[model samples]
Target: MSTLTDRLIYIVGPLKLQNALMASFLERETGAKCLAVEKFHDIQNMDNENTGQPKLALWDCLGNDMESCLSEFEPDFKEVLNHSAVAFFNVSPDLGIEAEFIARGVQGFFYEHDRIERFPQGICAIFNGELWFSRKIMNEAMKKDKKQTGLQTRYETDLSHREIEILAMIAGGASNKMIAEKLYISPHTVKTHLYNIFKKINVTNRLQAALWAAKNLS
Candidate 1:
């Protein structure tokens, strides 16, 4: 597995001092370079000059009003999604509004009051191309999956169970290789599954599939 030293991590939020302290902690814990940005525009400016390397972003939505912050950050979040970078939300511990952010293409969700020790592990999971949602949030997401029993009616009628699984993983921000590893299948098989999933869902790429999964599956 790769360490955080392999890539850059960007932390964005309205709380400048909090973000800076969090960045410092993360840097010390993981030995990964961390940047604390006050706004999405700062990220955009930095990204323009960034070398093409793997990067992860965390949007801290703890201090501000959730609805207001989400509304203000939606467009910037969409831009992050377009870049295919891993983006997660640092939110209040309550799972009340998680689905709203997930619908906006957030890959992971972290509780603001979680122990700082877990931060490194969560970051490593995301860095390694896996999800980092809290157990409660993950269970809620899975429960939502179960509640939407009529998959055929919700999405394309032709999508099989395995295809739906792949789609959900994609929406959870897993790469093809990661998906294959999790399912104990080869990368080629994962690609084949994705191809069929795209065809069934009438989507052209992973990003489209992800968005579709978020809207329909969740």
Candidate 2:
């Protein structure tokens, strides 16, 4: 089992010195290995071995406005996001895009004026499988969801019985390993089923798939 102490963290930003400083501070506070990367693409090269370990990436907003920050992610953010849980830091207040970030599978937000001491606590919480969202962000995400009473007809017709079972397990917050153990299969097979489920449902990420199941599945 992965514990908080053995997790990995990436502090990705444009400023090398600042990133290094923050990484050092976090390593001291959290007792986890921290790496500072100046370029986002550089992360793909550095860590290739620990696929099963829980990792978090802290992306710097770099004082850009919300729209520009989002546009910066257009190139290859999805691939990065799939590998590690991501949180945005140095964000300005009242961006009104928190809900959008949630839709895109962002796990947390750190505002520009937020206290520096809070970083370690938030990072540790996220590392321990918790979403480090603010109450306002949580409320915004909730308000954006559309409530449904039962499963949708198209989903019932399109998804196979096994696919539906896996989807339900996903919606119930089961991880791949847990699902695999429950269903007498390997984690790779569970991943294969999830990939097919994403394609059939037209969703890009796990959060979207879970939300789809929530709104359309009973």
Candidate 3:
């Protein structure tokens, strides 16, 4: 897991704008091969193949397609996902989402915007299996909308303000239960709200829903 040499960092997500700038920055900086797939379905399908999972797989929790890829498969990547070192990044990930992912198995979690300048360095550090956020000072970042675009803009003309709010929270890494609690509404309302967000975002699951926002929101 010494990431000093050229190695693959399996990338997934909408590969949205927030991190793309940083991803490119890292690619140029690290001399690494960042392999990406539109969805993790390809890897899931090739689960039995001998491609050998990378020494490090950098994933975004916001991909709904990956969620489906996970749900639909039995020998889920979760089994082999951590056989090697794993580092996770979230564009607007909050505690709840980060906790969920940690439960699923991740050594670290980072926010895209905050780490923009540090991604290149961070990935190498994380690849070594260190639980990285910071040695001191754990962090999180949330910005009010100033017309920033990730996957959210894809729905700008289609979604309502309430739906937009729910999407923001979801993208920021809130669960349906947490979203309901935060929005002061019933879980049923949260589901309804999320359903609308999903439709507008054109994704089937929350991860994808979040990824949509991550890629387009800003």
Report the C-alpha displacement of residue 39, candidate 1, in angstroms. Answer: 0.5
Candidate 1 local lDDT, residue 106: 61
The TM-scores, one per candidate, come to 0.68, 0.67, 0.45
Per-residue lDDT for 1-218 in model 2, tens only?
22357788989888889888898888887888898886567667766866776788899986677678777766667777777888889877766667777777887788888888889878866664446665556545645765322334545447888888988876666667778999999978888998899999998666677667766775
C-alpha lDDT of all candidate models, in order: 0.70, 0.75, 0.54
TM-score, prediction 2:
0.67
In the range 112-182, model 3's lDDT, one tens digit per residue, is 45546556666775553234543221112222222232223343547887887887776665556677888
Which ranges in model 2 have alpha carbons more than 4 Å from their true place?
1-3, 145-218
Per-residue lDDT for 19 in model 2?
87
Span of ten consecutive residues with least summed lDDT in model 2? 147-156
**How many times do residue backbones clash in model 3?**
14
Off by over 4 Å in 3: 1-3, 16-23, 44-54, 62-75, 80-84, 93-95, 134-218
Q: What is the lDDT of residue 201 in candidate 2?
A: 90
Q: Per-residue lDDT for 130-161 in model 1, tens only?
A: 56664456555545644554343465468888
Clashes of each: 0, 0, 14
